[model samples]
Target chain A: MTSRGVRHDSMRARNLAVVLAAIHRSGPHTRAALAERTGLTKTTVSSLVADLLEAGAVTEGGAVRGGERGRPGVAVRLSGRRVAALGLEVNIDYLAACVVDLTRTVRLRRTVRADNRNSDPALVLTGLRDLVKETVAQAEAEGLRIAGGALAVPGTVEDGVLRNAPHLGWRDVRVADLVELPFAVDNEANLAALGELWFGCRDADFLYVSGEIGIGAGLVVAGEVFRGTFGLAGELGHVVVAGDGPACRCGGRGCLEVYAGQDALLGALPSVSELVDRLKAGDRQAMETCERAGRALGVALTSAVHLLDPGRIVLGGIYEPLFPWVAGPVAEVLEARLAPMRGAPPSVVVSRIGGDAAVLGAAGLVIQQVIAEPGRMLGL
Target chain B: MTSRGVRHDSMRARNLAVVLAAIHRSGPHTRAALAERTGLTKTTVSSLVADLLEAGAVTEGGAVRGGERGRPGVAVRLSGRRVAALGLEVNIDYLAACVVDLTRTVRLRRTVRADNRNSDPALVLTGLRDLVKETVAQAEAEGLRIAGGALAVPGTVEDGVLRNAPHLGWRDVRVADLVELPFAVDNEANLAALGELWFGCRDADFLYVSGEIGIGAGLVVAGEVFRGTFGLAGELGHVVVAGDGPACRCGGRGCLEVYAGQDALLGALPSVSELVDRLKAGDRQAMETCERAGRALGVALTSAVHLLDPGRIVLGGIYEPLFPWVAGPVAEVLEARLAPMRGAPPSVVVSRIGGDAAVLGAAGLVIQQVIAEPGRMLGL
Candidate 1:
């Protein structure tokens, strides 16, 4: 293409992205409203809307009344039944898959409980493959075409490879080669944070704590996951809370994981649900254990608050179910340790999306890519 | 402007920014080299260079002698003598100012020792005004225009207001109102980190630890300081390393500053220089004090590494002079506490620019702004 042609095409793509993002974020809007919102001319917005409608990426909705002035304009929204994204997750004890439409609604979902901690990588991948296939078929049957997908791994994932998942006893697993989809892989905690950002609170900056078999944190800055220089950030579990405490699987002493990880909590209580039941029933042992765990979590998070100074801290995974039992102790330490000089302390809240955050976030990754380059997604 | 004119102007500005950034970062280069580097046509590069030359932002240097090529192209470089930036710093015991030209050469420098702790904000601002006047006069006399300036303060600054400076016993001081200048105010540690990034190592990500009367840190990510949601990130001194250790002035127990802050070290020794001299002379008390302080710093930094996973850690301020005696202990604790899953521990080193980092960083802030919008700075 000539330079002029290239520049025109780039401008058109940027305009399409702006229009699509406005619709995706603020729900249905008319072309006139979109033009006003995106600072584009009405002609440009109308042309882009026509292209999007023809591409089946958007659809006309109910008419938007113009306050008894001009003609009522047709409202446009992202096509919910046409395009969908798949989210897959591989955990120590479960394989899960979910499909979300353009409107961020779950179209299909499945979870199979299986102890994959001691399972071979090939076997686990095969199980996850079957689950994904089933979920994709369901979405197709429901008139949704899979735009793209992502995998959430509870491990250090880099360039489609699962480096290590201590809880699953897996290392160096090439997830992309086995998944058989145009999918990207990332740490589950990172995905959970992204999920919270897109589907939970829409906060620009916060710490999303994922308490699974091991504790991990997702540092979100300006609505993006802050992967450190080595892509190994958010290792909250390994932060030493005590100088000479119990050893952690990561070979660190007195790590938060030693006190608050799933294994530690489950060692005392049968299951998270059972612990919640006992806490509601006023069991002294359960209360003490949870308080202690919350304190350890608090200690680790105090360091996180100081380092990141996030606006909020969202507790996900098991912590969501255990928040009622843990909130007091966590808040106590945070209030005491956090610098009072900096306005009010960051608010601590339970994850609204709970356990589904990673799955939702995995789907969000595809949505983000689509929004970033609508022309590519539409094959324009 | 019309839409077409606006688009054209924006495109030109972007192309100019690309060309200017290339020259600033990679030093002088010919038009051909810049075009190739920035992926722009040679004609476009020439046009942009002409504008920059007219604005006095760039100057033609000696002809480039190409090996095995056609007619050599003339080299172009950023004009050094035309523009200068001023840096001002307010600490508990000193007021310092510096001026750096476009090429980052220090043209004027001054430091005045004053016990500003417990002093009135109006009086301190008056003193600072005199110091800044002296520095600016020197720079003006050298035939350099002051493009802009930034003030570094040892406090929680919000929009030019010093919210708190426990060490200086300052709070709610309207610094910008008191001192006249087109300057932005920021924490000293943050400025120090910026200074190190612009002038020292130029690492993409690192923690710049600023050890003053109280310990503070600057979290640098992707060459910019990562001020958290509230612009209060990198409160390293207040991170609770010990739950039951000495109380810190920040109201946190077992903070890194309680063990390693300049005041803590000076409490036992006469002064920073004397302590450094005693450590070099093998004094048992000085060695032990420095060692313990380093250990506490390591403990706090271990948390920092786990949370942010920076590639390197740079020790600045008072820690730079004490690095030789303290590096061993800091490294030992860091190595032992840092999670083993992440390949190797981040390298810890003393700041190359020493105590002048914050002052240099204040100047860097102006340079960054200038680089970001050269057209505005050049009155184009």
Candidate 2:
């Protein structure tokens, strides 16, 4: 089948990307192991590794023993320090940015609080642009090249456009048009899930629920975000928890948002942290609110478990800090309602990346692109 | 970059399977198209197609024009009639069996109604075995060879074992031991969804809700049944529709099953068809019951759409004939509740395969295996 008329350069480029992916996803492999695993010849593996090293996509270290055969051999791993990406986020209450490298590690992070609700999209983009540019300069000063970038907006993003952000009162905001960097736009929850998948969690399949002013979730199936046909897969907040409970902003009754959204749980409270503080200080109302929110979340997740069957549910954003107060009730509802055989109900857990998951995940998306096509990133 | 010690026979066998899949997925292709799509040489595709024809896995026909190109050439298609599979189902009230072929076509079907509720697992399997044997004999007399088989039970199935069938009063029933065939066991809803995927519907992603004595769903994502982390993904019946509506059999409050299950929807009524007849006669009580059930189902699907974001929702089993009475209220709920940006809620539709979806889908599973590895089916 001698390449079947395929271009030699493109084949080599694909092989390079494959080898890089092998190292990035469970790496520190010796050249011999990579050759065997990838089914490429030892000579070809050597040539590709040489190209990768020259491109600073991978680094080879001294003999790394204690493996399948326990024979000492030089090890190769990701040299992600050389290439990084910028992640920008515009939330209702804040604007954030971070730099993530090829190894899927967060290298720099910063957040600034602001009253962004009902603010003009252009004004918000100006503030976000400043934050991202400064962070990119900082990352560059540390000797990292910006390979690609993405912005995580708390909205339904499609074709690099933020279609809507209810909390921010934004509609059809194209952040890329205003931002200086060539960053694409994406949904916040989706990026956070990607961040957890790439940087924090070891499991490939799980649900990452990002709790902000509005609750949204990212359905991660088979290691990729399960974006629906319309690319708007996870909108957990809108799922009806009670068929006749209460009126919701989305013209729905008894929606999870009406019960478990930040505003619902924290009325007039500045932040989730303050609510936690009140609960810790033995405030009965705060404790009741947390319990009620947890129960509502559990009801919504019961439907999610039935529909998606994710392995685990990671609560990110506001839910992360509030996990101690919420996870117990969520798990309780799951155990009682879910059929005993759906396997064990999905284990509820906190996002290890905390509130910064979305921003870091956005940067991780770029790093993913770089690792998936190293030749393209390195100009071949 | 040769074969890397991979066996020549294995590679050729894989190439044969690849060509067969190409035809089965989107077929009636000329040899040139097969070669182009599979990245195999024209000579290689010709050799593989020759082997497939020899194995009776494909049929070469007269010139079939009108395709991507209006050129005239002999077209290759699935010779599924040569190898068929037996699909058996054991639902709460009936046992069904069907024969499906490599082309995913149902050649024959039969159903026997019985009070399977609270019946002994052994007695039920015996009846099912007899039905399957007769179906196999009938299919054999029609010149079709049974290559493989599977059983769809109204319960949880894992590793060819019926772990539990609550409606059937069965637990740990290993039907393969009694059925004199190499029949695998699977959940009825999962098989029904697969049946719809392979034989009825063109779309790959959908939620096939099988409304029976107990409502269950098959979550089809990326053309495969998404058995959750625990292989019990589409337990839509147990998904909380009303957080505090009523105590359910699963010991949960406000489960969709409590409101939408067969017994709940029909009560003293005998069957869904009877209810439809009553509704046609303008029976006020019947119409009210269906509307209420539709509202409850709509509430459950709202959660499903928000979490899974399936492109479509297919209601099978009893819901097929009942679609006229229920789909309106379901659509109305979706239109009212779902966030406008989640990209228009999933369109609700009836199952094209009618009530026999599970049995047919079960057979399609075996046909899929045959197409995937034609050599194995041919005892290579």
Candidate 3:
């Protein structure tokens, strides 16, 4: 093609994305409305809609009506079925995968829980690869083409490389080669935050604390995940609370994880359920332990609140189930510690999506990529 | 004017800004170089440059060197003389104002030292107005026109409303009407961070801590100040240090301010200089007090470092002068507290500009706005 033709095609590609994004964000709209909203001519919008329809990124839905001077017309909606994305997670306790379509609807999911800590990366990745293969096979049966995928790991990730997963004892591991399709790797905490931003009711700026064997935090600022300079910003578990307390797994003394991590709270208990049962029975030791852990979590969050001034704080992982025992002490510390200028501390809430937040968020990231360039998805 | 004509003018106005910003960021550039840099056609760049020149936002200079084969051509530089911006600062102990040209060079400055604590807003503003008047007169004498200005207050500010200046005991003060020129108001710490970004050697992501009577922080992320959800972020002095140490003026107990604030560091010394002299004389009490403050500062910053992961930390205000005595303790605490994942802590440096940072940042902001839309500055 000539250079002019290439430029023309690129311009149309950008306009197609602009129209699709408007529909995804504001729901369905007629071609006339799309043109008005996107500041493009109706003829151009009609051509772009045709291209999108051919690419299976959009479909004609029921007639829409508007207040403006215009006749009711069929609406263009984001209901693509031919394209799908995969989401995978590698955590200390589980390996999971899911397939999601263009509408961000999960088509299939499988989670296998196991003790992944100190496990060999090759063995763990084999399980993850098998799970992804099942998800992709299910997508194929449903006539959904796998466009891309992403892996969410609990570690510091950069450029599809996992620098370290302290709980998993894995470092410098690359997961891109495990999947047949194109994929990205991201820190699970950041992905969890994105999940809250996409799937949960809590939108705006907030911090998502993902607690498991290891504690991690994700900062949602200005409606996006702020990963910081090294994509390692929200390591909340390492915030020094006791200042002279026990050393943590991450090799930091007096870290919040020293008190609030699973090992710290559970001690020799086999499972969190055991501690939950004791708390439910009003066991004094369990109650006191939870309260102490809560205060420690509170101390760490107090510093986080003052430094980031997050609009709200969402506790995930074990904190979600333990919110009853921990919220009070957390609130007490925040109320007493936050400066008067901040009138009242933000509410501490439980995770709505729980453990699946990261995987779902990973799928949504792929959906975002497809929506951003439907022309590319169609191989235009 | 016709609607099409209005759009055409607005497009030109935007293009004018594009050209000016290119010149400001890249220094002197020939029209051909600008066209290549901005991906605009040579004819378009020439037209935009002409508009900027007429707006007194750019000056042509002789420039003839290039790697690519081309004829020697005059280069356009950001060196406007007629249009200047004003910067004003209100602190606990002084009022300051400065006038700067389009090139961000300060042409004149004035500072008046006074006890502004608990002073009436009207009285303090009156003094500020007088100081601004002198600065404006000096600009006028130099044939410079004041296009706009901004005020930096040591408090939380939004939309020109000073919500509160904890150190000055002032609230809900408005300082706009005091200046005749178009102006804006912002938090001092945010401006000081901007000052460091524009004037100091440090660029990219860094946190600038402005320690006066209150220790406020300005988070520079992605090369801009991140003023949290309510534009009230960076209240560092109020970060809880000791869960139950001492009640602070801001109604928080065991806060960092209780240990690290200017009052806490100076104690009964009456001034920072007295404390500095005592420390110079090897006074044990002074050394111990500084050590405590440094540890507290380090603790609060550890949280900030984990939460924001700023690439660097700059200590301004009193910390600059007290660097010799405090840097060691601050570094020690940070080393003991930060996660081992972060191999080494970000270097803690002292502010190079010191007191002039905020005022100069305010001026630079005005200069930026004028450059952003030279057409608006010229009233086109």
On TM-score, the leading prediction is 1
Which pairs clash in model 3? none
lDDT by residue for model 1 over A181-255, one digit each (tens)? Answer: 457999999999989988898887899999987789998887678887767889898876875677777766778
Number of the top-ranking candidate, with lDDT as the measure: 1
Better of 1 and 3 by TM-score: 1
How many backbone collisions does model 3 have? 0
Error of 2 at B39 (Å): 6.4
Output DockQ, candidate 2.
Answer: 0.37
Candidate 3 off by > 4 Å: A1-18, A30-51, A63-70, A113-115, A119-130, A176-182, A371-380, B1-22, B39-44, B62-70, B126-134, B145-147, B174-182, B370-380
What is the clash count of model 2?
0
TM-score of each: 0.92, 0.87, 0.90
- Least well predicted 10-residue stretch by lDDT in candidate 2 chain B: B1-10
Best by DockQ: 1
Candidate 3 per-residue lDDT, tens place, A313-364, comes to 9998888888899989998888776646677888888889987899988887
Give the Cα error of residue B35 in candidate 1, in Å.
2.7
Clash list (residue pairs), candidate 1: none
In angstroms, the error of model 3 at A26 is 3.4
lDDT score for residue A68 of model 3: 61
